[model samples]
Target: MKTSKIIIYDEPTVPEIQIKKLEKFLHDTFHADTEIRKNFFENREDEIFQEIATTRVFELKKPFSKHIPTKLEIQIEKENIDNSQNEEKILYDGFEFQKIISKFIPSNENDQEILNIIFTNKLTCTFDESDFRYHARALIGTNPAIISTTGIIEAPAKPKEYYLDLMVNFTKESAEKIKEKYKGEFLEYNDSRITEVVEGYLLQAVMYYETGEAFCEDRECRLYNAHWQKELLYTQSNKKLCKNHEESLRKIINHS
Candidate 1:
């Protein structure tokens, strides 16, 4: 493995992630020393909050033209309150947010071999020049990676029938009923299956940092890029990598 050690930062708001369990998962899977820390955003300088606020994406259809955030937005960033029940969804420019995080990392720990993975409730999206729009991403991989709990839930498409049923009569009461019909068909905010699903992302992040590839084309691989919730559920619950990835994993570990 390229990275000798991995340091994971916790996301306290979403306890379902089971970050501690994930720390163990990393050690067992990669044979790399894993360390867990408290929330990375806590006690950060005020300017960092201000900078983070600016990365918010207001227009999904447009390219990322840095948003000038309001005082309220900056305050909201500083507060970092639980957003589990938020009525309005907030999105951030993924790469820009990554840039801000890179700045906060200390020089000694900034090297390639000391990987840092940050878990956050924030939904991160990237602007696709080809599509000319932004799309939600669960993992933004690099030295200091971001694994978004919000993105894992919101990025993948829900059941087609569920959305189709929702479009027929979109009211609060009706939506509630529709959601009930497909309760177990897709992931909900507090789904117990979240921990297993997150393990897949952890694999992706570490592999991406070490191998320069974040995803696999194989459907059976945990590293497969899943666009739908069902695929995520199936691939993650299988709890096994494909033949090629398993081989690659071995080679990486052997070198380490």
Candidate 2:
């Protein structure tokens, strides 16, 4: 409730996002001004894309090292910025990508009370020093929070048996059959259930902005950091916050 307004930048490639519905969701939840915009990466200069391309993560286990992008890579960046749907599965260092994006935000609008949440099809990942590896993150919290639709699908692990089956029978056809066998057990590309899953992430972003806390330990909470596909669906099944978070949200709104 500390936020006076939320400006959401859409990811046009993913039509399942349905920006208008998400806008309504935020307005209804917080009684705050909600506005939707086109993808933030659109219409950016070539140099900006070059800078963003430099944030690409190559060695997943190693820490970030600034990448010197190839001409082809830069061209791909431009195409992606133009809202082309032919995006390759490129990995980007999420925090470094966020810093690049922050530079493009209008200086006047860069204030604490206006939450800028960006939605993207790109996979946003962070290198964990403790684990010494990269991990996909659905929501990177803060003023300009990023919700990666790809991350939502890819970050959470699928059922163990599915992986075990694929590990043994590893042809493309077999893999496709394995995925088909576990179809409804996890989120897939172009899944309609993304709308509900995304709502949870948006809630997490707002909660983080308001309280400086982005997650709940309870699997029943929408703010719970889900590591598995089953957990993600279970947490989002009812689309309700846990009792304590609900109370905190009420207090914030009331005080506002």
Candidate number achieving the greatest TM-score relative to the actual structure: 1
Give TM-scores for every candidate, taking all chains together and pairing residue i with residue i: 0.97, 0.96
Full-model lDDT for every candidate: 0.89, 0.88
Give the clashing residue pairs of candidate 2, or none: none
lDDT by residue (1-256, candidate 1, tens digit) is 7889999998878778788799999999999999999888888778888898889999999988888888898888877645652235689999999999999988999998899999888889999989899999999999799988889999999999999998898999999999999998788888889999999999999998888976999889899999999999999999889998999899999999
Clashes of each: 0, 0
Q: Which residue runs of candidate 1 sit more than 4 Å off their true CA positions?
A: 85-87
Expressed as tens digits, the lDDT of each residue in 34-126 for candidate 2 is 999998888777888899889998899999999999998888888775452325668899999888888888888788888899987778999
Off by over 4 Å in 2: 82-87
